[model samples]
Target: MQRYFVTPAGLTETEVVLEGDDARHLATVMRAKAGDPFVACDGEGTEYVAEAAEVSPGRVVGRIVQRRASASEMRWRVTVAQSLPKGDKLETVIQKGTEAGAYAFQPFLSRRTVVQYDDRKEAKRVERWRKIAKEAAEQAHRGRVPEVGAVASWKALLAGFAEYDAVWLCYEEEGRAGVGLKPVLRAFGSSLGEGETPNLLLVVGPEGGFAPEEAEQAIAAGAACVGLGRRILRTETAALVALAAIGYESGEMGG
Candidate 1:
């Protein structure tokens, strides 16, 4: 069934009111009629199986059939902190990362970053990235949309390290030294207490990767410097690989 993320106001005791783009998509694109089934999520973990009750111009109302639990989210809330890469590589990361179970995306400007940070275009760009995440989340059957944070400065990124339970910085130097992600994740996983849901931050630098000092600062701020493997991954690829590793290690990928 098609899934739609509706706001709390859009969901009531008995109905789901999809408005704007979702309404248009259901009415025109999907050609949904009364009784057509779909799934609705409130983006706060509550989900419902519903059928179309009314379809009109710019509005589609769905009658709630039953509430269902969606086990699509990873046990760990892993946020990807990516340094702004040139071109549309960030878009690819956000899309693929969402499908791979990233809880959120945090874009930051690093020292080696070549793309100039433009404050004027920041809002529009972030908005587009969020839309990409939303579409990807829906396609991935995720109950909640991944958050796309505004680009942060290097210092700001480091300062925010305290917010997460653990931070892993993807460093090529570590990869060259033969340090792999598995052992680090294993150790971290072992440290978790019963019923604990860890907030993991995976940091990946830009095309040139992080500057020596940048990595040093992150480490000092409590981030664990880790490698994906012997082969260094592109900035865009690192986060997705890490997310997959997290899911597999957490048993979300199955035995």
Candidate 2:
């Protein structure tokens, strides 16, 4: 069944009203009509099996048939703090990162960051990124839409390190001494007792990677400077890789 993320207000009294772009997509793109079945999620881990009760000019009303907890979301919470990359790469990162089960995304401006965002443009950019995350979450059957936060500077990013249980910075210059991300992950796993939720934050740098001084600063801010193996991955690819690794280590993938 096709899945969509609806606001809690959109879902009420056993019916979900799909309006805005979603309704347009269903009416024109998907050609959905009355009786067609789909899934509507509240973006709070609840999935409702629904059928089209009414289709109109600008809306599609779905009557809920059944409701259940969402299965696509991972038990662990992982946030990716990515340095803003140039062009459409941020879109790709938002999409893939949502599918990989990221809880939130924070775009940071690093010392080596090539792209600069002014206050006005930054708001527009965050809105666009959030839309991407929403669509991606719906498509991937994610229980919740990953949040796209406002752009942060390196200092701001480092200052927020204490909020997460574990923080890993993907650094290119780090050698074999830092190559073992899995061991640290295992140690983190051991530290968690049963029923404890894992909270991980991954920081990926820009195309130019993190500056030496910046990396040192991040390490001092309680982030582990970890290497993602030998080959250098693109900024977008690096975030996805870290998300996947964290998901696997947290048993979202097979244990």
List TM-scores for all candidates, in order.
Answer: 0.98, 0.95
Q: What is the alpha-carbon lDDT for the whole of candidate 2? A: 0.87
Question: Which structure among the candidates has the greatest TM-score?
Answer: 1
For residues 1-255, what per-residue lDDT tens digits would candidate 2 score against the true structure?
A: 888888877889789989989888887888898999988888888889999999875899999999999888877788889998998898999998898899999998998888866788888888999999999998888988998999998889989999998899998876345575787788898889997987878999999998899888988899998888777889989988877777888898786
Candidate achieving the largest lDDT: 1
Cα lDDT for residue 189, model 2?
86
lDDT of 1 by residue, 78-178 (tens): 99999999999999999999999999999999989988889999999999999999999899999899999999999999999999999999999999998
List ranges where model 1 is wrong by over 4 Å.
none
For all candidates, the clash counts are 0, 0
- Candidate 2 global TM-score: 0.95
Decoy 1 TM-score against native: 0.98
Error of 1 at 63 (Å): 0.6
